[model samples]
Target: MKPVYITRTCQIANDQLVMDGVEAVLDYKEIIADPALRRRMSRIVKMGVACGLKCIEGLTPESIDAIITATGFGCLADTEKFIESIVANSERLLNPTPFIQSTFNTIGGQIALLRGIHSYNVTYAHRGLSFESALIDAAMQVNEGKKNVLLGAIDEITASSADIQRRLGMTREYELGEGANFFVLNATASGNKSAAVLDIDTRSGRLTDDKLIEWIVETANRNGIEISDLCIVANCNTATTDNIKKRLSLKNKPLQFKTCDYPTLSARALDFAINNSTANKTLIISDYQHINHSLILLGRG
Candidate 1:
């Protein structure tokens, strides 16, 4: 299999969006401050466009083949507001814009419209695997001869949703935050610095410790790799780390980062692995509950 090249990448956090000391393409606070739903939707569309534009170095808008997005909680603030309005006013005279924007595919549609990309646009919202699904889709498209693709993920941590997840024990103890991460991918290799996604696998059931080790070994073997070739292994939780160590007999030492942040902040691990220098490859293992949700292999081209 050929490696898909990453043209550029950008990230926006709740606190601020900065790239090498420059302000981000969109300001989160400014967008949230808008009271009107229509205006807020417009702001989101603009932000998506700005992110796409910023990620594509010198390329123009016409260069993009498609726009794809993955958002775990799509327009959560709008959803919460709509629900609150229904409750406060006894479900009478409810606005429609919030309801419209609350759909999971709204960001993708808005991005397509802004970029005039009539090509294969899609949005995936599969919990923790949301962004990974989008990445896989983008890579497949690139491998199928598409020139350039814009892939992104965005999730908002609204107050009410945070409270609900807290009660359900699905969120972290700290305050919920919002962020966006975007990337541009192409088929042609470039001299620019980028991470190559080798393989992505997803499973639905709980994996036994031995089964998890077997899965990793098989995946690596298929790609002509050995256990010692991996420089790092990133897992979703400490339990996952221990499971890999015990089952795989890996003693290279793993780095685990767990804080009172977003529960799905495992995506941050991907970001960390990509930025850091490693010997050969980095294996990213993400498990949800007892289910082995996703495994991604990443390396340089």
Candidate 2:
């Protein structure tokens, strides 16, 4: 695999951890840079474009070869608006604007238009693995010879969707979170201090405790990463996290961030780990459910 470096990272979270408390909603005014354009765009679209712009602040948009996005729940506010419009108008009259912006690919489309980017654009909505899938695709594109890839993971939670998911027993961890995170990746190293993505692997299927160890060990071995050399950032069951820690005898315990089941935050942890530590290597382990797992290895050079 071609080596890729995470040259830039930007995160726009609804609840960014502040000294006193979390910032409930991100202020897009500074990010958008134009009041009229910001007013015309939806919340998710604004967040997406803002995060993408921040990630590639110095780089030219024309240099980007692909724009990839991942969102488990895409444009939730617009989706709810479209549904409410149908009910309010007795299914006869409807607002076409909401309906037009309520798709999974809307974020990617909006970003492309805003940047005048006509490169390869794609969005992945694979529930739990959405962000991981987007990263995988971007890394593949870089390895396939794309110069630069703008990858983003965005998810927003509206009250309606939050309540529905709550009834379905999905929001047990904490209050719903919404955020957009963007990363600019290139095959070549940016500088001596650049953070490099060593490997990214995902597994889906049932695995016993022993099988889990084998899977983890195999991935580490494949990447030639010693377990002792890793700082794991994971959001998994306590038992699973403990088991991995015990099996590997990892020097650094797994790092769990604030949000659970939020892929963008998980991706953000990669950025945090790289920036906050002097360690040469770190790993991100994600498994909201026990069955499927995504592991990302990040190394600094």
TM-score of every prediction relative to native: 0.82, 0.88
Model 2 TM-score is 0.88
Q: What lDDT tens digits, residue by residue, belong to model 2 across residues 1-301?
A: 8668877767776435211122334556765777877776677877777777767666677898999998877888888888888998999867787888888898788778877889999999877678889988999999998977988888877778878878977777655667777877888777445688888887776556677678777878888888788787765656666787777887776776545555455566666666665667787777644445677888885
Where model 2 places Cα greater than 4 Å from the true spot, the runs are: 15-27, 33-36, 191-193, 205-209
lDDT tens digits by residue: candidate 1, 41-113: 6334445544544555466657788788877667777777788899998999998777888887787776666
| Candidate 2 displacement at residue 163 in angstroms | 1.2
Quick one: best TM-score, which candidate?
Answer: 2
Off by over 4 Å in 1: 18-50, 172-177, 242-252, 257-267
Query: Cα lDDT of model 2 overall?
Result: 0.74
Residue pairs that clash (backbone atoms under 3 angstroms), model 1? none
- Scored against the true structure, residue 297 in model 1 reaches a CA lDDT of 86
